[model samples]
Target: MWYLGSWMFPVISAAMWLGMLLGMFIYWEAIGHPIYPSMDRGQTIAYISDVGAYKLKPLFIAGACVTTVFLDLGFLAERWLRHAGRLAPNTSRAQKVLSVIAILFAIAGSAGLILLSNFDTYHYPRLHDAFLLLFIGGYWFSAIFLCAEYQRLGIHYRSHHILRLSFWVKLTFIIVEFVLAVVFASTSYTGKPNVAAVFEWVVALVFTFYVLSFLLDLLPSVRTSHHQPQGWALKAEMEKAHHGGQQPGAPLTNDSAGPNQNRHVAPGDDLEAGAYRGTSMTNGPGYPAEHNDLGRQKRRGIGRLWS
Candidate 1:
């Protein structure tokens, strides 16, 4: 049995989520005052207004409800597959697609909030609201999906490329969104509502915190990579081979030379040697054929590092 409790990941995840929600609530309500007054009273009136009378409530509520139902259905289906042992307890392409959709919905929700804040008479048909509501609901559902995927990928395949890619992608997107929010708040139309401005700032702050939390969670993995055991014997042997051909008091080998001695030398040793094998040989005073080869090999190794 894959006991999720065996690891502290769940506890860490719960703590992170709780912290984010609490921080967002505090900033939105008390600190940032993102919710605006129902009607513009003047330049001096604060935008704190009751949630019930807010014109955006219908759109928000409808979007939230429909998205929630769709997400629930998806969750149940996934659970069914898992329980029947038909799905692996790891991130699959399906999960990635679902996560992308969830991210889209979250972005849409944010957009809706921004739009509502800007336009006082923003009204749409119930059908349009339904679509928005569905996306809103999907946001939470997608969050759940992400949690599960993290557990499966982060814990089961700690160093997997998919896990790394997902983490970086999410982090990058969050950072970009935060930057966009700042830009939006700063450059919005003059008549934009105050509530919307506050909301954008609050969300930006929330995303900043989320990014920090993710970095914290990823710290251990980063440390493990840096400190992981490597084959010292192999590294030592390579170094030994590199220095083996050095002659005492001889000038250091030329920057170009076939390291493996497998290439034919041209006149003046200027013929490009070891072209395909990443080794190069060039003749010059103080340039050892060995060093030239090693240098070429080293250059090749550096290229591989970039790739």
Candidate 2:
């Protein structure tokens, strides 16, 4: 059977998140935008949580939980693809650390979303607010870390414009969400519940775009029958260049040797009798007693090197 690329993860996540918010708004509006039990008299503008707390409790909780689960999965998939060389590898220790940190933050944000959805504002008001803060703050910090990581990745891999694009998308998300979140908080605290509710809805709407931005990051890793991902192609080119334009595991030969001969041994070439698949020159016993003249150790191959 045919399969779609991992990009579907973020697409489904964004769709579900947007659908949940839209469903709540439309349903509430259809019911004449009644003042929810949690609201004061004359307050006709219900927060997303307020609407979800009453009639659409099940839909809100399920949608938020499912959307965030897939969102976290998307973040995890990107990191895995990067390490597996299907996407651009992290070129520095800092990049690797930042990627992991970003994933952690995404997971934390997902947890907050799930918790806040379950803890309706009508009941656990304080806990709901706290988890909402966590949900927003977690994603904001995640975007910041991703922007830093992608900036470094883009610097090292200038040809991949997708990195730059993803960086800017996330940076824009951070800026927009930060501003809206601050305003939402200020309005909520200053007795302007209607204004806060409007900003809250806007914030959720803007967050859908943030969810969609992962598409830019994951698109390069997509593969199909007639197509290869740019990430895979670039990785292949780098590997080919590193191995002197010769196919990996091919017998290295010198001018004096036959075409198929493996007589030529470079400084760090695996010398374990043509075992080139897994044996590393420095990490394993690939270096036999006869090849002691080659004193230097190359990196533990591209995986560890890039990682």
Candidate 3:
């Protein structure tokens, strides 16, 4: 079974975010469920920032800081895993570029979230609103880049259906969040404070789903018996071979090719054998007559040249 330690980061981030928001809502409701500022007293809807801006400011700051930090770390770790070949490697130059761009946007989004938490809407309404835009826009743009990269990767690596699934998941999140954000902003600016507040909460709730979506991207990295060992395991294997006076076995060259196909075939090569042994190909019992003849001829030629 794969060690699931990496899975916990995003899970913790999502759980903390959901718990914090739910706690804020419950706190607001318990406190007489007052109307938002600049709205009629009959209107009970209040923006997350409104509820978070006053007495629960510390909770908001802490939650935002912790959530974004863990989320960023999860993304960074996912990128590292892909590069380290624990996950699928990005085969195209565009895919690599898109990946870097996505990470940059994610970092910007995390920064925006932290900034917004620090600059509360109660005091720095303008700065808070600006940071809110940065936060929303940065993450949405990040998702857009990720969707593009995953789409390309899915097309190239058809067997790994997880890439396709991840692309669709991020695409759906992008579309839904974009629409909700537009409506939320429109309502906020059009004097529909209650409607905006309702949409705001809906947006935050939906974002929790997006935050958790990273788990899908990371699922393919789960170490299995078939997978090649990595990092410390690789080092330990090498050290054991050194102390034991035995040569280490060849590493897996192609994971998607097939289990029995251990040898790599170069383009235009006609050889059909397991692998090269020392100086000659291993022409086994099942090899074709022509290949066997060629192997014998090569051995004779080498013997004559050496003599």
Candidate 4:
């Protein structure tokens, strides 16, 4: 099980890296296509007004579908692990709630995307606008939820500090992307798509780094370091326990003694108690015989004077 889990992390990271790279290639191709001739700001505005700008609903539909399926799989895996008593009991409540919210949003966004794609209209407004809005909103929410999960898990990838740092960085970029999308929705033409496309590329680059960091941490050398045995710490703890069991200037005995035997000592007794060492006088007497040296001296002096 250990070996398999160790291998799984790298494999998954590689897959994500490849997917992001392919996505970036396709995005670049779309932007540089000859059919959509590059135009000045005024020309671009006039073109959008004449054609009634359309949203890219198909992309949102695809993204939503993928997200929904993955979320379901994640939930199944979580439940299975819990049933096997493998999951930690201290999982954050906020993380779980956010996960559920992301799943719901993905499903709703997927439905909206599909509806907008299929619906036809004589004088209907572009459905891509609505689909884009939902797509950006759903993905933004899901990204936040995923980051929360990472924090809740206390993940600190040994090989890459950038993974931790770039989480917030990517989150900020996503927010910016969402804002750009909103701007595009409001205006007929503002070169928003080009700007959004650039942000998308930036997101892809950050995601690639994120995956690579995970991969580096998963490498055998890195993994070994992370799991290295804390021999010195363990030795120190054992020594402390051993010393705690022994007391200063006391015999180490394993005899079956009553609980109070160590608490109460016979009067004038010289044996040290378990944790108490002070002497005490016997009751119903001025002092015990062993402690009456002054009285004996006084008696001898009176005999000498009488003689």
TM-scores of the models, in the given order?
A: 0.27, 0.78, 0.72, 0.44
Number of the top lDDT candidate: 2
* Model 4 misplaced stretches (Cα beyond 4 Å): 1-68, 71-92, 112-125, 155-307
Candidate 3's residue-wise lDDT over 191-304, tens digit each?
Answer: 788898899999999999998998888766666777543333444554776656444564434354444457666667654443333324436667654454555656667543
Where does the lowest 10-residue lDDT sum fall in candidate 2?
298-307
lDDT of each: 0.42, 0.84, 0.81, 0.43
Q: What's the candidate order when arranged by decreasing lDDT?
A: 2, 3, 4, 1
Q: Model 3 shows how many backbone clashes?
A: 0
Candidate 4, residue 214: how far the Cα is off, in Å: 9.6
State the TM-score for model 2. 0.78
Clashes of 4: 1
Q: Write the per-residue lDDT of candidate 2 for residues 1-307, one digit (tens) a residue.
A: 1257788888999999999998999999898878888985567799999999987999999999879988888998899889898788888899999989998998888889999989989899999989999999999999999899999998989988889888988999999999999999998898899999999999999999999999998888878777677668887878888888887777565543433255555688644666443344443455565553333433323443311
TM-score of model number 3: 0.72
Error of 1 at 16 (Å): 21
Answer with 1 or 3, whichever has the higher lDDT.
Answer: 3
Q: How many steric overlaps does candidate 1 have?
A: 20
Clashing pairs in 3: none
| Model 1 Cα lDDT, one tens digit per residue, 1-307 | 2232112332343344344344444544564454344334442223222231253344434433343333333334344433333332334776556545655554554455334323323333343435433433434344554555555555554543444555555555555554555554453335654545455445534543333333322322221323311123234444666776575455466634435466565556533433444344445557876554446546656534322
What's the CA error at residue 149 for candidate 1, in Å?
1.6
